[model samples]
Target: MLSKVVRTIARPFDERFNLTNRLHESLLDKPVPDHARRYYFCFGGIAFFLFLTQAITGVLLTMYYVPSQDQAYSSVFYISNYVNYGWLLRSIHNWGAQLMVVFVMLHMLRVYITASYKHPREFNWVVGMLLLMTTMAFTLTGYLLPWDQKAYWGSTVTISLVEKVPFFGKSMANIIMGGDKLGQATLTRFFSAHIMVLPAGLVLFMAAHFWMVRKQGISGPL
Candidate 1:
């Protein structure tokens, strides 16, 4: 009786979309390398999982976060102290960001050590490099959202380094800060990039990376 009900519900969609076969082909039938069963080779997947963790927790954080000079710190404080399980969520997000970076670096290292970025996989290597940069941007932007003294000064100090990049350095720094100095506009810009721009870029790069992997069939054992 239950099987009949499921079949009845699935039949139309199956006829229209062939969802069952597609899922079996894409998911169940996909071949994973034997090395991928090991922990070290699994760093990329771990980092990807952490990215999802950050996305979920970040969206929740955004619900109460204020992107303004005046209210940012207060909003974070409220979330930490007042909201139910907000502290736990924030903690997980924070740790997840840190671990994501660590795992991404480790993944890159494993790829490099295994020489998996050769020849046909070189473009995918470039994509992975971009992913690493995007991950760093995520961390840097989220750093200032708390609006604490440490976050403010850390961001200021870090952005200052961009001013050393030759002719366009100062200009780039101004654009990032949204002015000659950091203020409400800076916070808003960072928040926008954190929640929107970076995520979009990450998704695009990941899709391309996965496509290439599917096409190229992951590097052989070595």
Candidate 2:
């Protein structure tokens, strides 16, 4: 039985299609710079890991979440109070978001100070910027989903800040608020953007970012 299982696992690896070989060459064959052994050089990887953590925890939270204005707070309260490990999920999602933003910015700073965004790597910088923005949007949208006092006021303050953005300020604020005031529509829109729109943007930009990094290789040791 053991031999058969080994053969089954090994069979696909030995196929003529060269899939395993290609994957090994693309991933396992890559080398790390000696400098990457240091802690700060790990910022980018840490940021990506935090994003994955957020994605997982966010999805789990959504399963028990109620997006309606009337029940949004009650649902969150129930999860935190009643559901098994629900507080753990929310805690991970919340802190993971904060850490993700910090690490992404730290990674950006490391790249900047090291001049990693030069020459063949300039485009990856743009990809990173877009990813950073998407992460922040995820933060904002997720913040408002609970519809609690803090979340409500936080989003209101955010809209007020955007409302100061000159010509398009009021228009954007109105769109975000779902009307002249914050209401059920605001929660619904925020929940949609949180679980749907911004995540798609993150995935798209993250894929491009990783592809570019793999193609260009890591920046040289400084």
Candidate 3:
């Protein structure tokens, strides 16, 4: 009876997607080299996991967060002090952003140190760098949502640096600021970027990164 139930659950997926054979070829039949068994080699996977965690937690946070000059700090305080387990979620989101960036950097360093970007893997290397930059942007955009002293000052300094760019500096600063200055417009733009544009970019690049890795095969030992 149990065997029959298992077969019934598997049949539709088998017919529609060739799930069994694909799984066999992609997982069981694929050889993962022994060199990849090391702890140092797993940072990319860790960063990807944290990115998923950020998506989930960020969605939950938007329920209580308000992106505005007058209310942003208040909302964050309310979440931290009043909502149940909101503090934990906020902490996870904060440290998760930092850790994700760290892991991606470590992963990139490992690849470069091992010369894993040779030949066919060079494109994946480029995609990986984009992913790292995307992670950094996520951190930067999310930093100002709290509207705290630290967030405000940090964002100001960063945007000020943007204004130092040669020909396009003022234009880029205005676009990011969403106005002549950093206020409600800036908060709204950052919020939109943190939740929408950056995640979409991450998804597309991540898909390419995985596909390239599979196609080129994982880098062998140095």
Candidate 4:
């Protein structure tokens, strides 16, 4: 019975599996192409590596972070000044985030220029766009967590900009701020969005993105 079931499942897969054989045949039966030596083929892998670094560092930083307006700045300061190598970890998390954003952008540009968005890759392109937006949202929401003058005014500017978006702009700003202005309420909201909502969304999108990549396989060099 088990053998019958195994054969049932394996038969369709065997019938459809041509690409692997074709790839092996091409590689072993013919000469390799020259342009394949370029470094650009590795950009996606590098972007993924940066994202893993960000996740690890972000998790560590969360251990010491306090989300309240009064304590947020002080907790970050303590991490920077008191904890051993905490500053280095936090700095890497911060700058690593910036670099991840840059790399993801470059990866997307590479995909677009190579026309990897065509056909079976269109959904992957959409997922990449969502990931990009989530990265920016993470940065914006995180900016408020430090609660310094820079963080305060930066968030204030962001909220003000949101309030200019059109019909529901003011309401959207209020929803994000959790009230009329930036305060404890706003801080709490941003913290929740940063640590919870955005992360959740990113994870969902990332799963879809990666699954699509595996299914469709890497785009060939143009």
Q: Which candidate leads in TM-score?
A: 1
Off by over 4 Å in 3: 1-21
Clash totals for all candidate models: 0, 0, 0, 0
Off by over 4 Å in 2: 1-19
lDDT of 4 by residue, 145-201 (tens): 889999999889988999999999999999998899899999888888887898889
Q: Point out the higher-scoring one by TM-score: 1 or 2.
A: 1
**Model 3 lDDT per residue over 50-120, tens place:** 99999999999999998888999999999999999999999999999989988999999999998998887
Q: What lDDT would each prediction earn against the true structure? A: 0.93, 0.89, 0.92, 0.84
Model 1, 32-55: lDDT tens per residue?
A: 878666788888889999999999
- Listed in order, each prediction's TM-score against the native is 0.92, 0.91, 0.91, 0.81
Better of 2 and 3 by lDDT: 3
- lDDT rank, highest first? 1, 3, 2, 4
On TM-score, who's better, 2 or 4?
A: 2
1 against 3, candidate with superior lDDT: 1
Which regions in candidate 4 have their CA more than 4 angstroms from the true location? 1-37
When 1 and 3 are scored with TM-score, the better candidate is 1
